[model samples]
Target chain A: MATCCGGLKLDPAVREDARRRLLSVRGHVDAVLRMLENDRVYCVDVLKQVKAVDGALAKVGNLVLQSHLKQHVVTAHERGDEDQILGELMEILKYR
Target chain B: MATCCGGLKLDPAVREDARRRLLSVRGHVDAVLRMLENDRVYCVDVLKQVKAVDGALAKVGNLVLQSHLKQHVVTAHERGDEDQILGELMEILKYR
Candidate 1:
């Protein structure tokens, strides 16, 4: 448990997986930026690369969600904080 | 076209559309974070919110791709730089 965050920490394996996924996503983002800078690349080809980057990012998001669920949400339930957290989550979702 | 970026500028309408979409995605992300912090919320409910956030982000990604295609890709073709740009894009896609 990480006291500062007041939630359980991610399992070591999950943390490693998340790290790798995040780095992979970063690499994809950088590549996309370089493609945009190069003058000879076709517009359609760039679009395909952008799609790849999007997929990589979505995967990373999944990793984060998985870690959050295992580390924080589970622990919060034992502490009886689920209702307040749910409200906060709902508030965050209400964009308009 | 903007000289600083050396690409065509986004149309005013597309830019406005992108702005709105980005803000919507941001709101979703914020909501997801809050959901994680709350303890009373069920893990399953938080998962649903995360899915909604993912969808919003995907839509925002589409907007970016649309703007980039219309603004940058079309202009690069006029400059006879499609070949180089195409190579760069292909390079970006080769992440593995």
Candidate 2:
């Protein structure tokens, strides 16, 4: 197992939820590709589908972030890993 | 064919490029799913991968938006579609 900071693992339920959401996002991307391939698709319609995928992906990110906060961030001080946790949080924030 | 606003179609080259990028993003999402499934995955590492997918998806959106601007927005007045074009532009801006 890839030991995370503070030696805490992702909550199992959260991990499963994220995996499921990611798969749905993958399917959403496939739908957008199909729209692009069609000869008569509207630009606005394609944009809407693209936007939907974006929203879905954002949700996935939120799910992971929430899980990380609950499983790792919440317990950082007691684990004596507050500095490492803070650094990791800062790194993830850059992507947001 | 689904006629787009102003009767303009997406440029074929741009459409193909967007499709290719979307496929790559789909694969990227699959990789994230694999990471989530692994017993030892780090939350920060998983988050970084998710962020990479977000960036890639944004690039796909930009490619489509650029093509739309070039093919449709640029020629709207000449085609007497300024009002419709404006509405569509506003709608897309909400997504951004």
Candidate 3:
């Protein structure tokens, strides 16, 4: 589903949401770093802040994965391009 | 300063810390998904969980980056391998 601006598969609402999520994560990261450097933070407190950042990252990853599955995977399956998906995912796993 | 563990520069303590951070993030991710699926969760609640996950991920990334800089980047600069470091980082950025 091409939008008026471009050929991105995600809807405008989703795109905006994703952007906001990324920005929020960036803010959280900066805040955590500042707290670590500028404040006499306890170890457990720092860990808690780190935990929050990771949770945000995971949620963003989930959202993007869901969007990809709906927009790309389903289309790929419909077109019978199972091998492409498999290869791409496998390559990414290998990167890790 | 290579350690006894096959020339890795990071101390065992750091390795353990990184592993614990990763595990904690995984737990948070699971909890968030569970809440999303099984609970009548509020949007703000879910977003907060997501934010935590992102912050955790950022912390992990920062830890790894700091360790690598102290171990690898500084060593590379000492050994006159600036080009390798630049190329590798550029390749990763290109992947994104």
Candidate 4:
């Protein structure tokens, strides 16, 4: 298990899953670009694609957040980093 | 002016701007993938980047929506496509 910042762990499987999803998202973005450049794409259709990308990104974020909560938040007090963990959680939420 | 579905117009400049933003987003997603593969990135840090991508996508969606509203929705009755325009708007909202 590799440690990230604050010595928190992110499961390798979870990281790999996130990477795969992001790659797909990158490709999806490219497809949207092609639609914009080549096709006389409808505004509603373009909006649908943009929303799909947004939804995909949200899922990736959730995967990371879930890993963090499972691995770090659960054991914060034992590791004596509760405040730091709490603050990090708050930071992520603020953006959402 | 080119017409999209329902003969709605999307401003050329707005479409160009969206293309540029989506290109940036594609690159950003690549960067995040690199961070995951190489750096022992903190979960919170990754979340911030993901949120940034989401924000950028939202801005692009807004640009498209704005164009639709200005060019199509406002003139729906004149074009006799009010029902179609209203339905499309509702579809986009359902996703959000």
Q: Which candidate's TM-score is highest?
A: 4
Considering the two chains of model 4, state its CAPRI-style docking category. medium
Which ranges of candidate 2 are over 4 A from the true structure? Answer: A1-6, B1-6
lDDT of 3 by residue, B1-96 (tens): 012222324434544565576667666656655544422233333444555665667667567556656666667667676676556445433422
DockQ winner between candidates 1 and 2: 2
Q: Pick the candidate with the highest lDDT.
A: 4
TM-score of every prediction relative to native? 0.48, 0.91, 0.45, 0.92
Clashes of each: 16, 2, 20, 0
* lDDT by residue (tens digit), candidate 2, A12-89: 888888889888998888888888888767777777788888899889888878989988888889988989889979
Can you write out model 4's per-residue Cα lDDT over B34-71, one digit (the tens) per residue? 87885466777788889888998899999999997898
Error of 3 at A27 (Å): 26
Candidates 2 and 4, the one with greater TM-score: 4
Which wins on TM-score, candidate 3 or candidate 4? 4
Give lDDT tens digits, candidate 1, residues B1-96: 112233444355544554465455555545544544444443335445555655654564566566666666666678887786566445644642
lDDT of 2 by residue, B2-92 (tens): 4564457777888888889999999989888888888777777888888889899889888888888888888888988889888978987
Write out the backbone clash pairs for model 4.
none
Q: What is the interface RMSD of each candidate, in Å?
A: 8.6, 2.4, 13.5, 3.8
For candidate 2, the share of real interface contacts preserved is 0.60
Place model 1 in a CAPRI quality band.
Answer: incorrect
